[model samples]
Target: MKTINFTQMKDGTKEEYDFLAEMEKPYLSLTVDRVLTELKNQGEDSLSGYKITRLEHGLQSATRAYRDGADIDWVVGTLLHDVGDGLAPQNHDRFSAEVIRPFVRQEVAWVVEHHGIFQMYFYGHHYGWDKNAREEFKDHPCYQSCADFCERWDQSSFDPEYDFETLDFFTPMVRDVFSRKAYDPKVIKENQVFGLPEPIFHKLS
Candidate 1:
């Protein structure tokens, strides 16, 4: 009863499959812990040439979003948007998006999935790549949201001197996000474009 008796996919009984599902609940519940651990690991090493560590970059991005009056989904999505960079540098945006897609709004996930291309507007030209490559998604509802996310949070977050919140400050928000029922349509809000709030600091400035 402790383990599924069958090695082959076609051989498992319903009782064994149910047992496995039951066993997975604890692991699934610890998603937030695993994510937090990865974020902490990001702080242990700096990406070459960047003035700040990846963890700091994420903290800055989340702080900006939180200050902008973004909801929990937006703030958490922005925080983990680069989590995939450690393992999948080539297409980290999409990979990061998948990591949160099940528990967040569809609009937020879409922005995360495409933020990489949208970000090219900032530095792709230095290497002779098309800076406007993101134009291909101009018609998508979340395009502007993604652009703003990159401009306001992602691209502007490398400053070492910026006062960013610590990972502990965002731990509750992260736990709240990951605790949601996975893929709940009520939570996903497909095609709903809750775009970024006007920058709070902009008004102050």
Candidate 2:
């Protein structure tokens, strides 16, 4: 595909948004208005070709995870998992950890950091960089934490629409983008045990 700003891509569509406008806002009620706004305002085209705006991808992942039955905290972690992308791309694992702190549980937030390793594996495979995936993950604190995160909870326990009232967090703005996310293979596998057939929600992939 043509390389263009996520908001201004090959289709010439222009979507203006700022993902961090709500960074300073309190997340006391977990309002959909607040969360959905954050999703829309954020741009999606990757500044660094090395990856997509991780925040955008994380939001998609969380949405997919939640729609399939992931818990609230896990869903929350998915949304904020990569907020640190621009500020600390290489170190954004903690950036995500830091961003999600005020709203989610310490343990689930820890899992957000852990997601990096799994992502590196997934991304690396997607991008054809198998060798470095391990090196990149080797020393990260999130690595160990994620292993436990996966083991502590199997994918089956997650429910996609658990706190659907929070759909506002993803609706109007983020849902169009979020809904397009194809379910993660691991995520799908867990749900498949219960007969959740994977469906293509987006046309892009």
lDDT of each: 0.92, 0.48
Q: Per-residue lDDT for 128-171 in model 2, tens only?
A: 76724545555654455455343332221234332222335644
lDDT of 1 by residue, 1-205 (tens): 8788899989999999999999999999998898898889899854787889999999999999998899999999999999998888899999999999999999999999999999999999999999999999999999899999999989999988787888989999999999999999999998889799988864422
Provide TM-scores for the models.
0.97, 0.44
Candidate 2 local distance difference test against the native: 0.48
Model number with the top TM-score: 1
Q: Which stretches of candidate 2 lie over 4 Å from their true place?
A: 1-41, 48-56, 123-205
Lowest summed lDDT across 10 adjacent residues in model 1 is found at 196-205
